[model samples]
Target: MRDVAGSWKDLTDDANFMAGTLTGQVRDIAFVTTAVATGDLSKKVMMDMCGELLKLKDSISFARSDRERPLDVEPVGGGGTDAV
Candidate 1:
């Protein structure tokens, strides 16, 4: 039962991470396209986009690592008592 719960938590986390990553990428692309349309495509803008892309890649890597490892859960105390 605990194992199943852990798996569900991991799946939820992964889904959240992926959704966040995709949203960020979409936003970045929109920003870049807007800049280009406005004829403001400077070296700095390109560099900024590259940096954001790298960050997205790092996030994906971190998510993959989390999926590969065992899910970590903390114990909670019972009701109003401090003891578990």
Candidate 2:
């Protein structure tokens, strides 16, 4: 059971790492788009960066929703507790 718990922790860490990396990539693309739009860079480059940024944003939203899902729990025993 200890080993299983350790493995689960490792997996959670990896998922967090991947989410962070996705967010970082989105930020980098936004930066590049701003730099390009300032007339110091190319329009084509800005467009490409914007496209990648949008994709990353969608992915991040999905990941966040998945992470926030409510856990399933059951009530133990009957009648003694007050019902809300």
Candidate 3:
């Protein structure tokens, strides 16, 4: 019937929209990752993606925070190691 065809078309359209959104998100994340790998740690991902894509965004945020944190401590005054 005509109604069935219309419903199917609508379903396919929704699927296409979701797929495109997911693809774009994935590519965005990939670019962020590449940038991070190339010593650019300031990049972050923030968006209202669906399902696990949201989790991926959250993980990327955490990674950025961790990367930005100072991991080394320099000795105070003079060129010498701290008395440990």
Candidate 4:
């Protein structure tokens, strides 16, 4: 028989690499969004990503500089900050 165990290990390693990359992208995006939410408008999605995510990254980057971006509205009839 062939060395099937080695092939299996290789496949597992590939899968692990892919999964790690995907999860890392997610974590990076999350961090960037949180930073933006805290008024860090300079944050952008700079992680490696796939097709749709490439578009999303571009969108996020655009929003970072888009002057038309919606401002943070205060809560209506509730406790909230008055800062504009």
Q: Rank the candidates by lDDT, best first.
A: 3, 4, 1, 2
Q: What is the C-alpha lDDT of each candidate?
A: 0.57, 0.56, 0.81, 0.76
User: What's the CA RMSD for each of the models?
Assistant: 24.7, 22.5, 4.3, 9.4
Strongest candidate by lDDT: 3
User: What's the lDDT for residue 26 in model 2?
Assistant: 59
Task: Compute the lDDT for candidate 2.
Answer: 0.56
Residue-level lDDT tens digits of model 2 in 1-84: 144567798988888887787666656656645654464343222222246566764554454455457877677555468665
lDDT tens digits, residue span 1-84, model 1: 144557798888788887787677667656655654565544122223347676754554454455457867666675456983
Ten-residue region with minimum lDDT total, candidate 4: 75-84
- Sequence-dependent TM-score of model 1: 0.46
Candidate 4 yields a Cα-based lDDT of 0.76
For all candidates, the clash counts are 0, 0, 0, 0
Candidate 4 per-residue C-alpha lDDT over 1-84 given as tens digits, one digit per residue, 9 for 90 to 100: 334578787888788899898888888788877887788887678787879777777777776778447789867656665645
Model 1 clash pairs? none
> By TM-score, is 2 or 3 better?
3
What's the CA error at residue 9 for candidate 4, in Å? 1.0
Candidate achieving the largest TM-score: 3
Better of 1 and 4 by lDDT: 4
